[model samples]
Target: MNVSQPGLSRSIALLEREVGAKVLERGRQGAQLNAMGTALIFHAEALEAILERAREDTLLRSLGLEGSVKLGVTPITAAGIVPRALEILVKAAPKIHVSVTEGLDSEIAEMLRRGHVDLVVSRIGGGSGYQELAEEELFRSDWGLITRPDHPIARRASVRLSDLRDVRWVLPAGGSAFRQQMERVFASSNLGWPTQSINTNSILAIKAIVMSTDCVSLMARELVGVEVAARRLCIIALKGVENQRPVGVMWRRNETLSPVAARVLEILRRISKDELAVRKRVELPKKGGRSVV
Candidate 1:
């Protein structure tokens, strides 16, 4: 990028010759990348990522470090699952350092494709580009109505999406894929969305508000394992509401993970089995029923 005019011209000439097309659309103002240029840059960035991982490995080896991982997660997983996994991961391989980043589906999915993050742990079916990545399903959790234990809906012996229609809602930030998915449940049932709602991306905020008020929200059950255990919140458990929104480990197809990332992936899978077992021990809510955390 810091090349002289002559050097830059030479590099562009070489690239155009190799690709058999002009990589740039030159104009009097300067130049802009063509389709070929954009595609080449994407692959070039991926190549840089592969080399960067190799470089990290080399440096770690010389310095006698166990290595580190950059792990991407969604908010739901960050709530309980990832922390639980890390508890085991740290004890299992204490030397391996894991740097965790929590983001919305749109953000993390792109990071996975660009190799900005070594691996992404999230629910399947984000949208168009998500299906291109390979998946290793870890665990499945249900989505449903969540409310405080003393709330009126919590007292109902039988409930439906109709019951949630008029209630105040604690919704995710507007326009997030997660928020869209939540809104779809109501739309699918002709219930429409709640006109009265609180929007936030924080799992803690959702839990706090749901536990103290009648504002119901939808989320994966696994996200609130702790509050469920302590009886701080309860599920409105819907029947036949379509579960599997299963969370799993995702990475670019045909990509090889670095030693550190691979180790973390192994621990995530190992811990997920215990998560799979929790489906049998809900104590609070029934499985085979719709749930939200």
Candidate 2:
């Protein structure tokens, strides 16, 4: 009671006001419990303990630290970016359990609508349904041409849309936002568009097709950066066409995030900020290289 006397007195006074009884005494040391006060304090202490325990339980459950979060992402996200980000999330919150599903953007969006994933990491497409979702941009990157290191475009300092004009292409399907953006860019060019284009759903398949055939593909620069750096694929700059697109996180607007989901989102946003900072630090100025405008 000594430790919690002030709180207890406040509680008793509030109770006494409703009950019309004197429940506490003011003294030199502090509040003193009368007979009625003593009895009420015992019950109040017990109730407080129960409520505290209940609150702790609810907090833990809500955070999903003791439960699991279902998340969906596009293939490019699953392959590298998300996995790297999750590694950081695990380090920060080990108790959190996450189940990840990888699919093309359309499929993943459907999954999110059906209550499959608690959150989604995807491109901000022109879809009207996603307009109301709470979203934050994670990264922005320009589209670049990806091909085998020995591909003809690889030798060029900067590849023009005309350079890829006649090449057969392996591309993500029209349903994919990235694919649509690529198509739009090409359609605006003097090259028109690739009639010989093959629509693929798999990023791996696109890379494979580009490697095995005289085909070229476009992808976000960061998505293919590791492969480009390793010399497995070449990322040729798209001179004069700076198509910087934003990758973002989205969650249902009507739904409140569970504790676990919130924690995961926090981790993702933090990682995004860190990645953006690093990108900004190393990024070339607008006059020198591509800008994600």
Candidate 3:
């Protein structure tokens, strides 16, 4: 009558029929599942394990996280966050293997469109024809002016575009939103940003150049904070700039995610608070952003 007790009732029924003997002397003192009943229990235990494996395999394949997932990201990922996220995921699911690659935002986006990369982490621009790609805003950063400690303008707590009128600049490549923002700030001040520059996304390379020259670069405050604290570089707040730059997650809209990719995205959505705090100390927004995983 009680099918719920798999260990007792089921085993008793199974063993009694198999052995043609009263394996369990039920309704007696201390009577329990007998040797034959116990043997049946062990067999059922093994059978459960087999069924569980089948179920897990089916789920893993359906999610696309089992075999492999390829990702393309910008230089920042190579520096820390993505790699660290993968490290945590590997510890949790030892069998899942993930491959990560790095490239410029445009290049990564191309790879995703061509079915080359499963996911991409980069700046979203234009959004011209990415109907197949879905974007999820991950975090945002503020742009600040960075220069060597001894640079003439380094003494200022903050700087307006007018203050930087004659200062030489190192900027991102022509199409970057940051560069556009800088140009707009300069234009609003009735001045022009020096076009002679080193254009790069390599933070360390840019830092090295800034530390060695009188040139200034605009970047996330957290990116140069370490050098600032060490007096190798200094941060001058931008007085007339919009501080929000949204970083996002991108993946194919219609395609299914692999099991490993799904798990990686899970770890990535948690990336803002747990991962960013260690790398840049930036505040990750809660509540509004949608998570793919």
Candidate 4:
């Protein structure tokens, strides 16, 4: 990818010779993909996916184990459901390998479509227009107005959406679903946006800023689970069910999961159910592999 222009042109020329057709239409401007190139590229990507899957299976057969999975996740999912689910997976099936890619939903959608990832764990918000993909609900968590315990908003007996109009916020950047959720809350209540938006998508950064400063955040309750349980953060009990949504497993429709991936999926379902129960109750579950979240 970092090669010089002449070197790249030589490589493309070689490919064109092997294909017995001019894949690139070369001009003074630069080489551009021809119609033949465009068609070839689609099947090339599909072939790459098949090769990757075959390799994972071959490695599994050599090692006498289940296999590997390419797992895609949104940032929120990495912080929330993934950790607890993987913890159980490794203990239950230590021989299986997992590779995780963390990105925004849009980026992850493309990855899933191209077969760069075998499955996706993310929140479902209308979703990208990939009818080939299907989602299975794993857990549901509500969006909350969160702040430090001693913050002015937290001390209030009751809060309103208008109260947040003047509040400073540590929010995700405009493109994120989390940010859209926050905007929806304000718009539905006929309130203006926050006076100061301290933009970031990191749950860790949001929690750190909220605890050290007077800023508030609109976040999924499950994302701040450990901190909330430790009294380091608190939800204001606004928008109980209004913005609640399912966190699910998204994979290609009609494609059977690889053996190791199916095993990991089973563990994810088990851990997510337990994780949900804890958030709804005052205390956590006493069971092992189910209480980490």
Local distance difference test, each candidate: 0.76, 0.72, 0.69, 0.77
Per-residue C-alpha lDDT of model 1 across residues 207-266, encoded as one tens digit per residue: 899988878888776776677667687776676466746788888777677776777788
Q: Worst ten-residue run, lDDT, model 3?
A: 284-293
For model 2, the local distance difference test gives: 0.72
Cα-based TM-score, every candidate: 0.86, 0.68, 0.62, 0.78
Error of 4 at 222 (Å): 0.8
lDDT rank order:
4, 1, 2, 3
Model 2 spans with C-alpha error above 4 angstroms:
1-65, 130-132, 242-244, 283-293
Kindly report which residue stretches of model 3 are placed more than 4 angstroms away from their true locations once superposed. Answer: 1-66, 94-96, 173-190, 195-203, 225-231, 273-293
| lDDT for each residue of candidate 4 in 1-293, tens digit (9 for 90 to 100) | 68998998898889989999999887999878999999789768967997978987797769887678889998678887888888878887887778999887778877887788888998875657788888888877666678887776775543567656777888777787777767777777887777687987676898899988999887776778788777787776564237555788888887788777787778788887786786678554322212222
Q: Going through the candidates in order, what is the number of backbone clashes in each?
A: 6, 3, 7, 0
Quote the positional error of residue 108 for candidate 2 in Å. Answer: 2.5
Give lDDT tens digits, candidate 2, residues 133-240: 667788776777887877766666567887666788898876766677776887767556678888887777888888777788888776776676566777777876
Error of 1 at 85 (Å): 2.3
